[model samples]
Target: MNDMAYGALLPETPREFGFFVDGAWRAGHDWFTRTSPSHDIPVTRIARCTTDDLDAAVAAARRAFENRSWAGLPGAERAGILLRTAEGLRRRRDEIAYWEVLENGKPLTQARGEIDHCIACFEVAAGAARLMHGDSFNNLGDSLLGLTLREPIGVVGLITPWNFPFLILCERVPFILASGCTLVVKPAEVTSATTLILADILAEAGLPGGVYNVVTGAGRTIGQALADHPDVDMLSFTGSTAVGRSCVHASADSNLKKLGLELGGKNPIVVFADANLHDAADAVAFGIGFNTGQCCVSSSRLIVERSVAREFETILADKMAKIRVGDPFDPQTQIGAITTQAQNDTIMGYIAQGQKEGAKLLFGGRALDLGRGHFIQPTLFSDLTPSMAVGREEIFGPVLSSFHFDTTEQAIALANDTVYGLAASLWTRDIDRALTVTRRVRAGRFWVNTIMAGGPETPIGGFKQSGWGRESGLLGVEEYTQVKSVHIETGGRTHWIAS
Candidate 1:
């Protein structure tokens, strides 16, 4: 392979761009230029989907489902197709990685790792198809037989975010297809190229036309139409809490379809006095700064024990200072450019809010100078309180807010005080203390002595306002299927008495 292709394996770029719909490449109504945040240059121009385009895509998905091209396929056959797609993704890992880096503005190394994770998601979903078995209860009461079966929910509308576009799409689509459902995916306009390219890979892997569709456009237009489309059986979305709420409201106008939303989070990392300071610092850094803190499950709030708070802040600031920030294509860069200029402005606004809230800015508080790219310094704040907007809200940027707590009880209280309960991390050596905090923290995923460590085996979702339903693992497969109970009377008949 040439160096470009080889680097593609490590996260580079695709040779060309196109949108995949009904297993074919079709030009959209208009094109929108995607600019590289690291270089401030046009990466590629993608199809700017219109409302009519979304209607067409959803109609195609509905036809594919009604015709049973996917839903009627045998589980084993569907499983084989998904497995083949996973294999195809593995073979072109470098290409996918490169496309991800170019489109998503994540560091090359992180983009490559995300590509591997995406492959793993498909593989796991493929295997999960066989495990989608139901229960058969014979002879429940001498003459009655009962059986429970699972079937796919037709025509899933998958709306993914820009931060981890490929990973999020894999998390939703593979499982939906594995459960024998067709999908109409609308990736974020700013980062739709990688997903559209994957559509080509899936088509090559033998996914039937209309079984999977990609519609690219801004959320206000195409996204809203998809959510409100009466034909879509379910909607799976991952983005900001405000938009998630809008989706929920819009769904109410349609069929009130099954919804899965992974929304915003101001996830907390509570470090106790007994915690390993060095390890805590490193884990906290990864939690908040990974993906430039654009992740929904980011541990943005640090509730540290007052006894070790000062020292932990020092360690964290020193660590933040060392993160290499630059171009997304640079292998040595740890933090890549922000995804867009608007996102950069949003993050900077939050940094200013942190200062206005009286939180002490410890270190790294300004946007970086990486040519004309959208780069922000990894920021850390001290003297943060639970009542402050910086501590309560989801910034979705590379900003960390540290709150001091005097006791473990106080730490747990502060951690659970937010409207979001997506994920949280606890750093302590005591096993019993970890268990105690785990029980009290109202999050879907909890980490002890670690932060954001998992593979496809772990199920991911949120609690309360973090949104409903689960994704990944066997539970993820269940999300796409509906359960029905069949009851039969062999020797007896039931009668109702008149009142």
Candidate 2:
């Protein structure tokens, strides 16, 4: 995973890799192969870990935590290792970015940008570690003093999704490490390639044995095992809301492990008549088109002021027409392959549902045969009502449902109509409207004039079924720690002690 070795993988064809556990790379009981979504051919054969592997990885993490090998470290010491991890990621940025193209099919340029963001995530989490402090108060009697301490929450289990494998791991793992919690990671089986590389990156950066471990396999197996293990103190997962519900249930059925789920989002992008039409259109395109709109925060809903709806649709269609959809290895490919054939089918079903519901098809809306992998064109639906299945459900693809509103209140209503509340972007030149609209939007991240804004410094999660708990920033670090209170008697020992 070192930068010098990056060149070796760029001509990157299918390669076989093993899981990393207890600071050692090991093969699984069986194996699973993942095909390159762009090439529609096998590109990776990964270890399919069984229950025994899960036990071993989690046991290692438990030993590390209980031994205080990592949890007992001072904030500065933990921060140092986290910083090293960040540096390690920076060094291997190129190779890892390219691997993402092969494994996840994000465009090379976007993958590179995501790698940069990953580095920032570690750096920011490192900063948050230094800021992990508790408060002191003396509201009691003069002889009494109160203090609080933030302690690492013991071993944590992480299950990340494939849509942005590197991105989600960077978002979760750094904070967990910075909080001094040992972890057992179960990245999505379809895209475990870069995560395996990350295992090497972390170990090379000097993370102690058992302090960080990775297991690859089906989520129902390794992921469920991690969730059910009594030793795991917390579980952080990123995926669909249905799967998120299952995570919650597993936690409840097990030791009631603390759960942090960053789940599904049918996010909305609102445009006002006063906004710059072209700029709004471009932002909408980027929002839905990024990662082929596989992101939880993808703006699948476009609610525009009626006066600007027709014009905005025209501009967005033009932008979609200009997008390049082809091989992921090509740096110019704006939209690469969908993560799997099943996912492509699901998206197509949603498009057909839109058509059946009488929504107008403004632009693209069909599966493309690029002669290799799962590819879908950027799609748009017009005159969609809030109640349409396409507008209400999480398609998790490059599909946008278009709606219109005559007033700001109506626009807000349209945006808030979904079950999801992960993110929303508002476009308006009016400062009052921008502030008001963004504030009123029920989303974890609210963007004004700009869509998909924010970085590692900002916290992201969701409201309602989008899932709970924040990731990134100081809030993220807090999710991995438990607070304990201590009181001391400074004046004199009370007679009640003897009594």
Candidate 3:
């Protein structure tokens, strides 16, 4: 890593890479460049693949799946490869983190933390490979036996977003492979380096040829191709609800493939009057400030008890103001650059709209020109109505909108008011209140007394328009599998016609 002033890091030169297909690097007729969001310099040149290239990658995945080169391997053998991949990731932790920072524009420390979480995904998936099992029925008499088998769902198409690219990929890849499925990935064009690097690491870890392939290009061309490809047996997508809906349409228009989507969120964090205001305030700040509030599970909406709303808002504002917004290379920087120019503009638009809607700007709302690179100071808006654009839509930036509730029931209502149900969190010392809110919040994942807590051991997905199916944990592995029932007879069956 090359060092700069203020403890920032940069690459000596822009790294060049090709698409990975059929266990080999393939060049494209055209190329696209990804500039570092935090430095405004070209950091990587990725192959610009077309629909034909997508077909090739999908064909390779289909071939690999049909041939069963990886699927035929014993569970222990598959687990061995996943473990090796985990080890390889561990070895290249820092290098990968550097690339992640350059491509995704997240703080170095936060990127490193995501790498650790990714490593755990692989490790857990390795264990799951050996432990995942189908069901057998012994209830039938000696004359007959029944069984239910879980088999890989052929070729899988994975489309990941730019935010948390590597983490989202790792969250699905190992588990899909564990279930004996082959995959072709379409990573977000701006953040393709880590996904391609992961392909190399998997190959180094002895993953079979064509078992894991990566294709890069614009989402409209290559990404939609993956979703529409009939050979793809399943499509797992993580992005905005609009795109996720399109993926569903592509599936319905094509093969009606199994879909797993983790889309947008207007997640809420409710704090009761009796709750620890200090702790709740810290969590509220961290929840929205983390990843610059570009998280699907970010607690963007804060619904505090009316009595303590003013006090809690003050504490949260102080914490949000203290968040270090600086270079991605700065280990102490809690907030980094916006991942893309368009997203920055979108966030700014939301900030403007919030003001237009009469929401009070409690803290930072202006864009920061940090010498070079797109940066936004951590922002908070109070006195927000649920009808405001910032309050309703997924801003996906370092912005928090505040709301107040006079009762627990109102808090629950405010939390469940969004079209999304990806995640929700609440702070309360009373067990009854916590239990009630957790059960009635209408989110797939709920956190009580904490925020953004959990591991790969738990499943993650959404309800309603937030999308369907789950990822991670044992269910993550099963998500890529299809179940079939089998029946066997111990005694010879008598023919009805003959009788």
What does candidate 1's lDDT look like per residue over 1-499, in tens digits? 3233213432233234566678788876688888777666566678887878778888888888888988887778888888899888888887777667777789888987887888888888888987898888975987888999998988899999999989899888888888888899999988887888788889988988999999988888988988999999999999888999988888898898989999889899999999889999999988888999999988899999998899999999989888888777767888888898888998999899889989999988899886667889999988876678877888889899998889778988989988999999999989898999999999999999988989887799999899889999989999989999999778645668654
TM-score of every candidate: 0.95, 0.96, 0.98
lDDT of each: 0.86, 0.88, 0.91
Looking at model 2, which ten-residue stretch has the lowest summed lDDT? 1-10
Output the lDDT of residue 481, model 2. 91
Ranking of models by lDDT: 3, 2, 1
- Per-residue lDDT over 302-368 for candidate 2, one digit per residue giving the tens place of the 0 to 100 score: 9999997898899999999898987776767899889887888999999999999999999999888
Of candidate 1, the 10-residue stretch with the lowest lDDT total is: 2-11
Each candidate's number of clashing pairs is 5, 0, 0
Candidate 3: worst-modelled 10 consecutive residues by lDDT:
1-10
Candidate 1: clashing pairs of residues: 8-94, 9-94, 11-97, 11-98, 12-98
Better of 1 and 2 by TM-score: 2
* TM-score (C-alpha) between model 1 and the true structure: 0.95
- Model 2 gets an lDDT of 0.88
Clashing pairs in 2: none
RMSD of 3: 1.3
Candidate 3 C-alpha lDDT tens digits along 1-499: 5646355557667899999999999987888988999888888999999888888888999899889899999999999999999999999998999899999889999999999999999999999999888999999989888999999999999999999999999999999999999999999999999999999899999998999999999999999989999999999999999999899899999999999999999999999999999999999989998888889999999998999989989998898888899997876789999999999999999999999999999999999988988999888899987679988999999889899888878988999999999999989899988998898889999999999999999999998778899999999999889999999998788788875
